[model samples]
Target chain A: MARTAGSHAETTGPKVRAVALRLFARYGYAAVSMRQIAAEVGVQAGALYNYTPDKQGLLMSLMQGHMHDILEARQATSSEGDAVQQLEAFVKFHIGFHLARPEALFVSYMELRNLEPQNFARIEALRRDYENELEGILARGAAEGVFTLDDPKISTLAIISMLNGVVNWFRPDGRLGLGDVEQIYWGMVRRAVGAAE
Target chain B: MARTAGSHAETTGPKVRAVALRLFARYGYAAVSMRQIAAEVGVQAGALYNYTPDKQGLLMSLMQGHMHDILEARQATSSEGDAVQQLEAFVKFHIGFHLARPEALFVSYMELRNLEPQNFARIEALRRDYENELEGILARGAAEGVFTLDDPKISTLAIISMLNGVVNWFRPDGRLGLGDVEQIYWGMVRRAVGAAE
Candidate 1:
């Protein structure tokens, strides 16, 4: 049955989004249900409709919303600097930003297909923007002759590939600290970008 | 209700696994189920049990079995060479092997968590061994200074990351041929591990 304004105010829209993000990260989008989300959030499945019209809406909110916020955050923090600092900020942000929200990273990365075609296109554009962010940085560094790579597209794809790989194996309780993780990835990124002196 | 089988051949163990892989690749592991798999394989849900015990077993078989076969294929065709040649061969194998069997790659990489603890550990070990294959090459190259990496583990990890990222985007129908894909990746890999000329 469809729900209307009968839902309670104690459960806000953002709370529903947070719950959905965590569940999608754990169980994936298709594997999760309105009932499961409601059960975990202490609301009725119909109450979830108070926030999202459907599960696909929840996934779209999780991905496109999170990515938009990420792009905004990176934009706000970005500064004009020497190519190295710009690159460092980009690298650090890529690593630190993802570490701060593993759920968002995992779910957004894993659940692209669950979106409606129009929604998928929007989310894909946001992700492509994120990819292009570093491509610009690499192109700037390369144009200055400080960086040496044959093709920025291949190099950009490669650097992103290496950086994104960090999420798969990173562990806070493991021997490495987050700073160490950043530095190690930064080191390799430096080499790959021909930034190391 | 459980399925009753007349003979061992009546069990759809292998057939179910095959169908699961194809569907998991095309749709996704999370979106698939025993019923869907059964429907595709032309078997009843009850008949699925003859092949394996449960959904998790089917996922494990797709993963552990796939990795076993991948390792075997590599062992057969994998050549002995200095770290550079071995690395190229590994890159070629990684791309060729995955491009050929996207279904297996999709299931193994995506459905890892679906495995029970023992099953997860066993498949993880196989993954570690595969990782170690690249690590061995990196370690050899680092020792000879053919690879000027600050950390072999990072190089190993990064190489695998770049290679695996191919599956997320590569399409046979794309303008880039398999050989073109291999060449592009090899150029990046060569620069990554090439002797400091």
Candidate 2:
């Protein structure tokens, strides 16, 4: 009986998170209640506590999980080659990953202000780690004379900001296919970083 | 007596807007209430309605006012230069304008989802107008061979998105002054659009 209960919890846990993410993305985090999340997950409000401690924990878990998944997915991509190649890979990977998870991307940026101080710090650290990955590529490129940049840190931020905009407007039925959009952005990013062709 | 009443309303109207902007930026629009805004404005909840019809009206007013002010400010700047010069002016202007009014910028993006469908459409139209201003510059630049871009529309969005990021992290007393930040961004924008020497 205990094993069956544990198995049930394991299946229900992900459903709670999925519902929470969608609701939080549609309505800002401050406005969403744990009761509402539980309702959407087809569970009683009391059962939500068994899955997560509270609303804050739900938010932190969703955000931290997103960052972890992003980093893990990035690692799975083929990152072989020079800084230029790696930067291109980073750009393409970021656009594709974020495009597929628009809800997560939206909530990630929109709800950062709602995280508790400690939770905010932890999330920021995780984000900084992801950013530093691209900064490393720019630094490597600049060192090898393959790219010219005044500040790798600012460039990293600028490039990511530019890429993040894709989620705001890209649609599957848009005139430009994903490949076309990626190509255009890749060109602009390469130029922005002053890559030597 | 009527003149005095008119004068009082003129002052109170802006106060109401200022308070609403601050609260909405701190807490997402969905979470803030009319009572809270009125309390912050130091007026009775009913008095708040005299300034704006409802919460939707207030949100729409703030967003529309922001876009109108942006377009008007852009017009006030010297836009008579060539495409490259114009793009540089845009980069500097956007960064300065948005950085100075971080609250409005924050509310503008974060609360966009909370706007009613009609209000959202109107605000988007106004925003598109501002974007087209930049797109016009890029199109002209491409025509004159002063810039190389596959799509002027995408480049306009990319550049604006990148410049918008300055407000996210910029501080008045940071290591980089406003002028320094502008110069660095100008360099990147110039490169991103593929401006020729």
Candidate 3:
């Protein structure tokens, strides 16, 4: 049965998304069932239709929504500055933002293979938008002779890849704090592009 | 029915592993059933047990085998040299070896979470050993004043992460050939650690 429009949905909707993200991250999208998601969300299997039309819809919504959140947060955190300053901000922002939402980051990358063709394309475009943000910085830096780069496109991917690795091993209670991680990664990102001395 | 020792088992064994790797890479380990793997290998589900005891065994074998291959290949491809030369060899060797086995790399990283606890620990230890190889080089370079590194361990993770990103997007027929990619990545890897001019 479809849910009636009221406070119930407003509260239950976010709950459904939260449950789906966790389930997808823990078990790959292909292995998870809508019944499992509904059970986790404390709703009947039939009631899940009120939240998401199908499993594919849930996967796509979670992924696309994650991209939107990333872009929105990135836009808010990023500063208006020169290429070098902007690149540094990006390194710190990428690590902190991703580290805080490991499940989101993990599911987004891991489930891309499961998205339908059109959904995959949409998510890919959003991802490209994010990558372009950094590429723009590298391009400006290269043109201004402030950085040496053979290909800004490749550098953008390399830098992101390097930064993404932080989530895999970083621990707050471990030897290094988030600040130490940010500083170290910022140094590597800056040097990787051959920023001016 | 289980097959007795024969040439059939010898030939079917490798076929089973290859199919399992492909299926696991396509649909994650948890999602891909043993029946699916056996079907892909042109054998009955029961025949799969003759080769591997169960799904968990198959996953562990594939993962552990991949790590062993990485270590064995690293030892063979790595050349005896000073810090700078060895780092170059590592970057090139890593990219070449990984790119050639995209399916194996994909399944190894993605299905790691699904491995049983004991299996996960064994695979992680092997992974750390491989990481120690690069960390040792960075340590040497830092000591010799050939490189500047705030943390050798973090540098190892960063460099591997950066290089690992290559496998996700690289194509043999893409605009850049393998040699061009090796040179480009090596340059970034070198500068990432503050390698001297």
Candidate 4:
């Protein structure tokens, strides 16, 4: 529940995690010191100890938060639909999630090494859980003869790879709008899975 | 040249660039110092200047070199073939290029902002050239009625996005061999284009 932005118990855990995420993204995690985070939050260095034991814990909390949101977002967005519908919902939610939260993207990919081995593997497994969700969807689609694929697992990775890529090249002010981006990704996903428009 | 481990430079350049790239990747471009690079390369700080005018220039050169290789790989591998063949070649080439040379991958994504505005745009344009090549292939495939794509440009980005993602999860000792990974990627690309298996 506690995070590393500042030790001030008055600050909410999520708020502290947000601050630390932005800082870690801008400045690499190792480059930023605990004192700097305390300064940013207007709290005493000793105060941050109340929230997080160390910088690594803060990173773990931040990553886990993001991974968990992704899981919840997919679960929340998905409905009683077939494979394509579920996959579409997942893709839309994924792009929307990362685009809306660049700080989370930074923390998940950039600060993984900062997590202790046990914590790092834990979050990594959670992240893989999202992948598994997609894989299951692909398998169902293929099994139902709605989607065609030689190998469902590899196909799922390819789809996720392309979908996850939106965060790297997409810009809010860029030439394309969000809806178009979603449609574009869906179109590609369909093609990748041998589904027709 | 005396570039550091995993530098993109050929033999023609000086050693400073190599040392700097290796150091920057290890310690981050912002965290590394010109003196440290000089020390690594067994040269005095003053002598390092004779090779690169400044740290920014060194960073830009590395970026430029990476972009050049990417563009070159796109050109070299994507020639004298039909759209489908060219695209398959392109995808496999992309995986091979990136995996075989992590240096380019590290610079293109990790050390992007270190470039000066003018230099940065130059590198970006090279990347765009590669993207355009993919777009052209997809568009051609669609036009030939061999492929189905709603948006060639976005599909190109989507596929490349998936391809670039190999960096985050790929491990040589893993169960899947590199060839298997390439086959998986190619299969996805083919399906995504709506090409027959």
Q: How far off is residue B55 in model 1, in Å? A: 2.7
lDDT of 1 by residue, A28-128 (tens): 78878888888877778887887877888878877877898899989988567988788888988888988778888888877886777899899989888
| Candidate 4 CAPRI-style tier | acceptable
TM-score of chain A of each: 0.91, 0.91, 0.91, 0.87
* Candidate 3 chain B superposition, TM-score: 0.93
- Name the docking class for model 3: medium
Stretches off by above 4 angstroms in model 1 are A1-12, A82-85, A142-145, B1-15
**After superposing the true interface residues, what Cα RMSD does each candidate give?**
2.1, 1.2, 1.2, 2.6
lDDT of 1 at B79: 80
Worst 10 residues of 3 chain B by lDDT: B1-10
**TM-score to native of every candidate shown:** 0.87, 0.92, 0.93, 0.80
Question: Which has the better TM-score: candidate 3, or candidate 4?
Answer: 3
Winner by TM-score between candidate 3 and candidate 1: 3
Sort the candidates on TM-score, descending order: 3, 2, 1, 4
Model 2 lDDT at residue A58:
92
* lDDT of candidate 2 over A1-197, digit per residue (tens): 13344448767899999999999998788778888887887767888898888888999999999999998998889899999999999998998899889889988988998899999999999999999999999999999998878888888898888999888888989998889889999999999889865
Model 1, residue B112: displacement in angstroms?
1.0
Per-residue lDDT tens digits of candidate 2, residues B1-197? 12344447878899999999998888778778899987887777888888888889999999999999999999999887899999888888998899899988998878888889999999999999999999999999999999989898888888888888877888888888888889889998898888865
Cand 4, B chain, TM = 0.85
Local accuracy by lDDT, each model? 0.80, 0.88, 0.88, 0.77
Best by DockQ: 3
DockQ of all predictions against the true structure, Cα-based: 0.43, 0.69, 0.72, 0.47
Candidates arranged by lDDT, highest first: 3, 2, 1, 4
Give residue A177's lDDT in candidate 4 (0 to 100). 86
